[model samples]
Target: MNGANMSARLKDKIICITGAASGIGRATALLMAREGALVVATDLQADTGAALAGEITQTGGRAIFLQHDVTDEDGWREVIAIIRARHGRLDVLVNNAGIGLSGPVVEMSLADWRRQTAVNLDGVFLGVKHGLPLLRQSGGGSVVNVSSIAGIKASANAAGYCATKAAVRQFTKAVALECAAAKDNVRVNSIHPGIVETAIWDSLIGTTQGARGTRLEALTAPSIPLGRTGTVEEIAAGILWLASDESRYVTGTELVIDGGRSIA
Candidate 1:
């Protein structure tokens, strides 16, 4: 669609996105802002997050940035308070912050597992726990939790990552059911992205053997039916649908944005 003809799907909505400094989170932040949402972009990388918010403002969109550590309950409280004070209500929350720690289950340390769970699974719980009130105050909204394809399919070297993402998927369903039972208008869903072209791959597969680009292509070629990795923008598009009113009836579901990798 042309820029002028594009629908403002999230116009005037208040959206808070975690891990907004880079990758799918970054892409989502930009797209949501363009669609007229008041974007609050948060990430551990203060400089990059600030730059993203600044870019949105310079382009005539409304946005702000905050350094957020999603694992901290106190930090979440502060973030919600900021939204309440500034925007009065939150219309959407994207729990997109996550880490990928991979190793054989036998070789992985307890600390590693705990860290992965803390960010990927626990962070989503905290976001829903704290953000729900504001969403209700806004008269109901949506929550999009970013999981992974590993959540549905298992991988030998990524036991911890898979376990945490799987937990996120179930947690999303539980929250969706709870909201429905309570007669709340809020909807909850999870997005499982396959091999997206993001920097996370660098940490998942180290570059010692060859160039990072070559390693990434090799990693995705064998399994992905599309013969290539997905892009952050593609994943963000699904997230946007979940966050916007377009998916008003969708809840307690998993939106897989893989290149048919999970099926293959």
Candidate 2:
């Protein structure tokens, strides 16, 4: 089918995405809107988040920006409440907000670890804890948590990042089983992206090989079997599938878009 026909896959769906100011979240929000879903984009960054909403509106897509910090339980509550009040139903929750602190575990401070945990793992937890209710109320939907290849494959200096992402992976399966047993019609799944070309990589760039100004391509060349990094658009496409009915039978699974790095 053509792009127009394909774009209607999520027609009239209600989608709320966290960490949507930039990176994968931004791409997912834009893609979902094009698919005819009403996008509620949330992030801690007020300015860029609003700009994202404006960009979507200019393109004739429905979207709204909300300032949200995923680690705040009360904030999650309010975001979902507002969605319930205005839209009356929510079809998908994309817990895409996260951060990575690339360093040796010994040198990492407790506060830094906690901060990473709060966003990478706790954020996803809160999204499901609150978003699942509205999802069930909508008669069933999907929750797409953005995990990473670090979740499954071990790396040298990314212990904390891996820990949180791994937690998200396992948490997804547990919730998926719970939802299935209760027949709530909600599917929970995790997306494990390897090395995506996003802002997140900027911090990770100099951590390895002691090269402070090493290019991403140079770092990825010897590692990623596909000879390149993934893109936010590619990652967003996987997330879109999970959010759409096309993945109705898929849950409690990890959609790895890592270009063979995980296997390598």
Which candidate comes out best when scored by TM-score? Answer: 1
Looking at model 2, residue 253 earns an lDDT score of: 95
TM-score on alpha carbons, each prediction: 0.96, 0.94
In the range 44-127, model 2's lDDT, one tens digit per residue, is 999999999999888788999999999999999999999999999999999999998988999999999999999999999899
Worst 10 residues of 2 by lDDT: 205-214
Error of 2 at 61 (Å): 0.3
For candidate 2, the per-residue lDDT at 194 reads 82
Model 1 spans with C-alpha error above 4 angstroms: 1-6, 208-210
Q: Give the whole-model CA lDDT for all candidates, comma-separated.
A: 0.92, 0.91
Residues 43-121, candidate 1: write the lDDT tens digits. Answer: 9999999999999888878899999999999999999999999989999999999999877799999998899899999
